[model samples]
Target: MNSHEGRPAGLRERTRRAVQAEIVATAMRLFLEHGFEATTMEQIANDVGISRRSLFRYFGTKEDIVLGDHAEHGLALRAALEARPADESPWEALRAALKSLFESLPYAPEEFIKITTMLHASPSLRARQLEKRQQWAELLMPDIAARLGEATDPMTRLRAHALVACALACSEAATDAWVHSNGTIDMERAYDEAVAAVRG
Candidate 1:
């Protein structure tokens, strides 16, 4: 077995992540309390007990703070998709994959709502989130393509693109609805409905 296979994060790395999480938590509270546009980097830094420069070292911008480490893009989706039954149809497989990926995320819906609500309210943040989603779509294409087959054909490539786009759009719609409802509606049920509507 590889010596590093199950190793825990080193102290420095753990400390770094702790601080990063603190920054996001602090920044989010400040943003929610004060409004995104009204909050300043210095305010976030002071609240997080870090210098403004140190805050920059952790995050490049307020948008980055709000979005907070886009994470390993589509890894959960890729793994979930890969684990899906091979015989399932494209739509069903994608639907399952989307549901699985949504369920596997670490953050709670309340946190997601705050962040997503903030993202929707800010045009620049929305644009940045779209850029992140595009990156996710690009990264997720090959895995989705492999599942849908015909990887060598241009049309298959297009189909994979469509599937990814639709799946992401479903995700966006579900989250938008969930945030709109202030988390009162069932996001997953909304997601299932969106997929069903598209798959019909």
Candidate 2:
């Protein structure tokens, strides 16, 4: 039974999500094991027990397997930021909004290192990651501006943009620290430390 709707998810939707999650998990393992560039869609499709044609139905390309969730995450962050109390500091609200990101992490800390390490090492993936960050910042900027009580001043918009950019940078730094330390570091604490230094 699904607590949100008080009923189970439809069989097809549940099955689809399960299959996609399996594909993502398996593909990450493969990408880490064999370099991402070296890994092929056919290989992922084979490993996931689906035909290559069917894999395309779930994810358009190899990169999508890695990044398909970013769009949902951007929307989630925007919604979370909008839900924060009006009096909350933008930084605090952003930090809280990021809880959705952390909560949606699909792998264990150790397994996450594989994904992050691969992304850190790949230029193509890094470029796509930056694009996704820019998209997220754009999505959250309006909510941030609202929280700042800034309506139309250009400077207000710029400040909101800066805050969103800085928050993302802080997140990246913390994730990098955690990955470099082989996940021994607490990511949220690392993020807090980065923010403290940035704010100081």
Candidate 3:
């Protein structure tokens, strides 16, 4: 039998997750220190004490290493929304879900500022961020539609698109304001204000 055969499935999955988190953390540190363009996969692997091949197995590209955690956050957001009481309005559910999601991130406001700075300084990274946001929208759209009791029609898709667009715009605005203010402003309050502005 394989070495993992007798082990609990959760143990194997947790181990995999821990390794992946280490790789991403190492890559983020290197990118922040040396700039995204200057950090190579080989350097990350060396820092993480893993083979370059193993790094490639975890992340197909340097951008993937940087943004991999966002994928997990997206899933968490979906789960949060799904678990909301059925009587809650779509907007209320989305707001609560997003708050929970942001609260769960590993970064503090200072660290988030550094990440935002790195992303803004790199053209490729900024592009990749947009692509990942689009993917997040696509991942959430189906669930949003179902919650709205809408069939899979063109109109329903359009409504889902609009909701995701507005929500993301609000989030971006909040983060931008927080970063520009040197994190003196409360991010959660800023986010809530942005959502309220859009709601009016």
Error of 3 at 130 (Å): 1.5
The candidate that wins on lDDT is 2
Winner on lDDT between 1 and 2 is 2
In angstroms, give how far residue 12 of model 3 lies from its true place.
5.7
Q: Whole-model lDDT, candidate 2? A: 0.89
Which digits, one per residue and each the tens of the lDDT, describe model 1 over residues 90-126? 6677678777776766678787778777788899899
Q: Distance (Å) between predicted and true CA of 110, model 3?
A: 1.3
Candidate 2 Cα misplacement greater than 4 A, ranges:
1-15
User: TM-score for each prediction?
Assistant: 0.86, 0.86, 0.85
Per-residue CA lDDT of candidate 3, range 1-200, in tens?
78877688878789889999899889999998999999999999999999999888889999888877778787888898888887777777777888898888778878989999888788988898888888878877777777677648879888877887788778888888988898899877887899899888
Question: Which has the better lDDT: candidate 2, or candidate 3?
Answer: 2
User: In angstroms, how far off is 179's CA in candidate 1?
Assistant: 2.1
Pairs that collide in candidate 3 are none
- The lDDT values for all models are 0.83, 0.89, 0.84
Off by over 4 Å in 1: 1-9
What RMSD does each model have against the real structure? 3.5, 4.2, 2.7
